[model samples]
Target: MRIRIVLTFILLATGLLGCTEQRATVAVPQTAQASFSWFEYQGSDPVFAEPLAPDQYQNPVVAGFFPDPSITRRGDDYYMAVSSFTYTPGVPILHSRDLVNWQLIGHALTRESQLDVSGARGSRGIFAPTLRYHDGVFYMITTLIDNGGNFFVTATDPAGPWSDPVWLPELDGIDPDIFFDDDGRVYIAHNGPPPGEPLYEGHRAIWLWEFDPKLQKVKASSGRIIVNGGVDLSKQPIWIEAPHLYKINDWYYLLCAEGGTADEHSEVVFRTRSLDQAFEPYEGNPILTQRDLDPSRPDPITTAGHADIVQTPDGEWWAIFLATRAYDQRFYNTGREAFLLPVSWQDDWPTILPAGETVTYRPVRPAGLDNHPVLEPLTGNFTWRDEFNQPALNFHWSLLRDFARQWLKIANDKLQVQPQAGRLSSLEPVSFIGRRQQHMHYRASTALTLSASGLSAGITALQSEAYHYYLGVRRSSNGTTIFLEQADGEGVDIIASEQLSVSGDTEIGLAIEGDKDKVRFFYQLDGETWLPLGGSFDGKLLSTQVAGGFVGTMLGLHSRLEKQDI
Candidate 1:
């Protein structure tokens, strides 16, 4: 059966236009910002249509800085894993059924012993991983940045109490994936530094070895070279990484991502009749590439590779892969997210997104399926506005580091944050905040009345340990004033600041509009017209390149000592 899919693109008005539509032109609301509440408030609700579920199929199904997706299917269930970079609780596991809707399951690695992520640089923590199920066990194999190696873990359930990582002593390089052959022998394939190349050359070539699940070691005699990036023209001499093996009928298929994972990144596939034989390239090797998509639309899916194939209970085949969506010219709020594409077998080879060049919209739902689950709403009436009367921290608030018992207190309808001496750049601050990067355009505002004399308090949009964009009200020697600061590679800079009247209590508002890359600071005198204190500060500080960390931007409040030596 032939299916024709039509995708319609809608551009929502940002702050540049007014708040309503008259006939043909739509006015962008002045208050529109980059928060979940702002998106819902502006009536820019997500639609629940099929190809892409309006509400659930947000641009990045997996938000934040997650990248290099590897998914596996068990019966009607789906599990996905991604490169966690420098985040503490690495290897996040997501569960889904329809591929479009996903829920965050428990993290696979929780302890520092399993993966020492402390001081790991941006884009350099846990690399690409493969999630697979063999027998009654779920297995994951990945690499650790700054640590010399690849490792594997197992759990009885995908939403797991995963085991401690078993380091593969002989295995080297990154982007490790596992394949359990039909004969019950498990094979591990990864992109390792090519042979005879300089030891400093971190570039990878595909290598395979027999992995023992019992001993959790790479058998020395079982190692062999599979493919090299320097030899193949289409594969390119760049870095060939994120390799996964699949077996269909009598053929073993090898899939790897090439071209450096930037704008030129692509998914390449090849197959071999025997597991040990040299692989033959696919006639139409690059099953997927975004180079053909309209360059004007911000090409939501960049670096689209690191894919894994799975078959549903109904025998429908699909591939889950990682793709990044750009929020602006250079920033991606959702990071690398999980995307699904339908797959077809043509002449004993696999084809992905066969209907067209790019996945403009959701593909046709597989036939004979009627029990698809309903997608959940990604937005709601939630923001930084809080009464502080609750006994516990709201679900929206998460500490920069792990949550400790002694860092916060709630009583007398007030939230008191204990002053800590450490700088915010060390991820040691006791501050906590909410994170939801669903919309490219929205706003977040909060009111805080200070009670301490020597403490500095303010709201901030944090990207990582060292990078942040903040518009905060603090008590200087001149009295309470509003200041906007941004952190680039060099460090934080006060881009704009203004002195405000001192009082027993004051109201400070901060709004960040993601699309326009602007932030506006406002203060209300006696609850009147919101006087704008600052306007349109650049948000380039939130980019991964400038920010130099693995986490996406999160909105939250913080307090620090007036002096570093405190």
Candidate 2:
């Protein structure tokens, strides 16, 4: 909801809009500006809660497109990191005391020098990242799909200025995981091509290599194929990825995701007593999956796999994995989200979520721990707003590609963004910054003063490189106009347009109201009255299923210089 203010349009005289190679600060009306509302965003909506039990919590421990969750614990503190894929400052590092509650502390990849995602499309940059803490340093190893093959960064503190990529050009695979054995030996486990030619199309193998931490490279002579053709070669599982090694007692457990990370994704486990020997498949493989669950079940969580397990201080066990909640049996606009489930050992093998249970909306809290109040981002309900008063944007906010220095600035109690030379569809980084949608039904609005003569700026529900919806306020010879633009693979199309009376000191409000079915665009001169600018557009256009990507919808502010050269 917007604050209702009825004030005269007063154009403060300034040459802020026409300056080049410099920044111009503009003053906003005192009544029109308000401090940004603060709220903790979790999952697709505000976190779901039960009034009866304050200790109980919901699935999606970390929400909104946070996938391939890898967690580790240091004493009472717990840290989890997820794949950020093409977003700048990739691999979000979240911290928490209890696993149910989490907050974005920092990012492992902050500098552009650490990641090169020049022309990479959606879902093509970073894959699943394995976060491990060994000795006094935090290690994060991941695949830069199209950029470089594999690399790892290290830092003493989880919230870090992590070191640059120690590129493993010799490693030829994705979803890399690192293991530091007790005997001062380090190893890297990942899915790669078979020893020679594959028997079938998706016939991949899990390979292991001895890693030298001092040199930060793989030992060439120590390479070996651990698990070939997945669990059962006859059944032939596909895309064995996201491998993690764990040593318990005298057994080394290797867990990896198979069945292609789609609806059929499942976690399969293998164990071996020695690294030199091949790992044997567990009799009860696929310890976690929902594809075999009853289809008639309500709000089923599909695509459940890519799991990583962590033990609590109290000796309790838990598994953190990725799953997607489908709406109306088939539609799922919220991308894969992180889910937590308890793990119980039976006959030396781990079982997840019991025999017939899928992911629960509200699960029981871990035993023996005090019923502490729910924390931020997991506290469940509040509205989020940013005043942009701080020197830097919040850790949760990310740009499409590398951070552009000239794109945005904080000054004069307003977020000043210089219009960039490209549209949201272009591969180049534009003047856009956004957080994930995180909600099926919500309202996001921003107040902007379009000072430039030909500049247009507003909010967008960005789905991918070729698919998105733009609700922008434009200034031209015809005065201020609200335009609704849609960009599919075909091209950009203006679906609706409306003229506004406001001229200078253009305090126009633009909002995108979203529901499961559609998204509607609106504009307001006075915050009280909103005029619908475009017809309700189909929400499916932004879904991962329809958009064909590994990313979810991002709703945020964007600006463009209509005539600037790219």
Candidate 3:
């Protein structure tokens, strides 16, 4: 909600005007301002529209770069949140009545004061978040990697204006999950370094601390290490993170994501009769994993772990975790997605999926959920369009960081973007708003009236500061120049460009298409036919394999201003 403040300032200061075909004749600063008549973006992928039986639900209930999912329920209403990293309004909060049908309600962190991702890299700010509800308050506890340490925010209503961070300086670590005990006590569990130093490469520990819900702080001297180096340090389990503590059947169970976040990621379980006692690793330690499955399997869902289990009103147990849908070999542009599965108990140990079992595409619906299909599917192939008609931008749309300064606004169904000096190569926030590239074979396009000034306003498929593609139209006395620039290790290189003697009012249609490992850029002056701007470029660089981040590709509307104004 605070984004509106930054946008409003930008709109007024930059001579905000109602966007129309005629408004393009009115010129602002040639170097640093541009507004859109209306921006339209849609995805065309064929994988999401399959026929679903009345009794089954899709595996990835929520798709895209939404990873490290944490969920809580109140009666029949369920609320979930996912990690957003440096993108702000960080921590997208979603609501689901039937657990299968979900809607993005709002964001947990919105204001600049609430979340300052100023100097953080593309995937370096926010880490895994664990959302919980206790005593009529929703708590989102997580770590800030490059910014601050562990902190949490609270809100009476999950969809709302959450309080600012209450920093947990003493409770250091990432992926912090808060547990409210049945006996009126509170605890926080997180993945941290092992006691007394480094044991192995991926050696990590799960630590617990006594938390005071009243004071809203961690109690000093109540810290303890619950699981050292995963289920067993001798085996040297790597990246034992994302710990969620739950009490069921009178036993405190500690569940965590084992191994690094790759093909080897898995969830393991440990339990103890009391919090003060040593935890006993489950006989079948890694209760859930796809690592042992054949890599060449068809339509595979790999890198599954970081799971959190919840119970329905009917006492049915279900789990939500993060996984990836990859093509070729571990090449996923859609990022880590949220997957759903059922929890089955074997000899009192909760298991999401058996060791050798492959995660299914369509799983049976939770025991008693009514058939409520989502209006827009997040899984598989789906198309999403935004005309900027809403009072605010959709929660799914993201800025590079907090919308803290003058950059953009939404007015009269148009997304008015004021071009900024920062380019996609700068670590700081740029004049950009993006949506997840949610499919292996997909296309996203937008229409914008070019300023013909010192700005190039068009579309971008961005992976990071240095790894992205920009296709924009710049208008000047020299006429309209449509160009495509690719950013990578060496630097920005113009892949292709074209010159045209065009007017400023022409609503230029720009689009980006990605097919697995490659991408293409296009632009249109007539708004119907797409003229190629650049040949196919390597889309693999957008994947985590080359970009090396915790996020996926984002197709965004970008307008970069000239460095030296003429």
| C-alpha lDDT score of every prediction, in listed order | 0.61, 0.76, 0.80
- TM-score against truth, every candidate: 0.79, 0.90, 0.92
Residues 337-380 of candidate 1 have per-residue lDDT tens digits of: 56677788889888775423765434455444443443332222
Q: Which regions of candidate 1 fall more than 4 Å away from where they truly are?
A: 1-60, 198-203, 230-235, 292-294, 297-300, 327-331, 354-356, 368-419, 424-436, 446-451, 464-466, 476-478, 500-509, 521-531, 544-551, 564-566
| Model 3 Cα lDDT, one tens digit per residue, 55-107 | 87877888788888999997788999999898988899988888877778889
User: What lDDT does candidate 3 reach at residue 442?
Assistant: 84
The 10-residue segment of model 1 with minimum total lDDT is 34-43
Using lDDT, give the best candidate's number: 3
Question: Residues 257-283, candidate 2, lDDT per residue (tens digit)?
Answer: 888777788998998899988799988
After superposition, the stretches of candidate 3 with alpha carbons farther than 4 Å from their true spots are 1-32, 44-46, 563-566
- Point out the higher-scoring one by lDDT: 2 or 3: 3
Order of models, best TM-score first: 3, 2, 1
Error of 2 at 476 (Å): 1.3
Candidate 2, superposed: residue stretches over 4 Å from native: 1-52, 371-375, 563-566
